[model samples]
Target: MSETVRIDSWLWATRFFKTRSLAKAAIEGGKVQIDGSKAKPSKNVQPGQTIAITKGTEHFEVIVEGLSSKRGPASVAQTLYQETEQSRSRREQSSEQRKLARAAAAAPDHKPSKKERRDIQRFKRDNLE
Candidate 1:
């Protein structure tokens, strides 16, 4: 409801993180930036400010739209920021790449038996030698 909110609180309120501590960690870990520079958890976020956040393999760039110190529902949280078109496209591309990679590395239906494990180990040992 105020004109500005702390970055960590804003991130949590926007649902970018599950809790304020996580948001603070991300900010401190250099995973969150404002404009083009690193940001601290205490940074104040105002409308129209750009924020870049990296979470694991995903990246997001958003423009702040509203401010709220309290965590809200997804619908309300979404209204807090607008994701950049380029960021959305890049995120989708990366997501597709991850899906493809996962499909290619499909897990076996069953675990290897003792003999199979030994054979695999033996093959590796032979190759190493």
Candidate 2:
């Protein structure tokens, strides 16, 4: 309904962040950018404007398609922004790479067994002066 909405509020409304405070924090921490430059939480967002959001290892580049101040359902929120094809592909690639990395860096399940622990201790003792 509004012609322009606050970036932080829009982010939460669009479900980009779980809370408005987190959106504000992200804006302040340089995780959200407008037109390739950092913007404040209170910055007004307009339709057709591009925004870059970074969450964890995924970076999203989206064009604001609508503006709203109230949080809405996921389906409705998704209409607020249009993610570019490149951004989508990049995100998918990043996700795949993360999966592969996780698989490669997999750790043993649970803690070491008592026998394994004793073996580790013995190995350490043998190596130490």
Candidate 3:
């Protein structure tokens, strides 16, 4: 609970990342930003500052509420930042879209015919060699 903490350390402590190394990698990869700009792992974060993070297909924007450099329980980690309403809604909408897309991409109701199956096997065999 020291006042001075690196952005990567805070990110790991707050449960945003499972490890400090992951947090640092994210920062270096430009997946994490502070106040709308890319942030370095060595940067210091304080209350009232905005942070944006991209992890896989999800995006999060949060305002810092407190600081902690030690990982803690989920409840305590949640208190370290407050997610914005817009960010929440956008995440939900994107998830819903992905669900719809996945549903539309469902496998065919019937299995391939014997000749079609042979073609599929041939394609795989040719490509996987």
Local distance difference test scores for all models: 0.95, 0.94, 0.95
True lDDT of residue 113, candidate 1: 100
lDDT of 3 by residue, 60-122 (tens): 999999999999999999999999999999999999999999999998989899999999999
Q: Residues 37-66, candidate 1: write the lDDT tens digits.
A: 999988999999999999999999999999
Q: For model 2, give the RMSD to the true fold.
A: 2.7
TM-score of 2: 0.87
TM-score of each: 0.92, 0.87, 0.85
- Identify the runs in model 3 with alpha carbons over 4 angstroms from their true place: 110-113, 119-129
Candidate 2 on 13-113: residue-level lDDT in tens? 99999999999999999999999888998899999899999998889999999988999899999999999999999999989998999999989889999
Span of ten consecutive residues with least summed lDDT in model 1: 1-10
Q: What is the lDDT of residue 34 in candidate 3?
A: 95
Clashing pairs in 2: none
Q: With candidate 3 superimposed using the best TM-score fit, by how many Å does residue 47's alpha carbon deviate from the native?
A: 0.6
lDDT of 1 at 4: 79
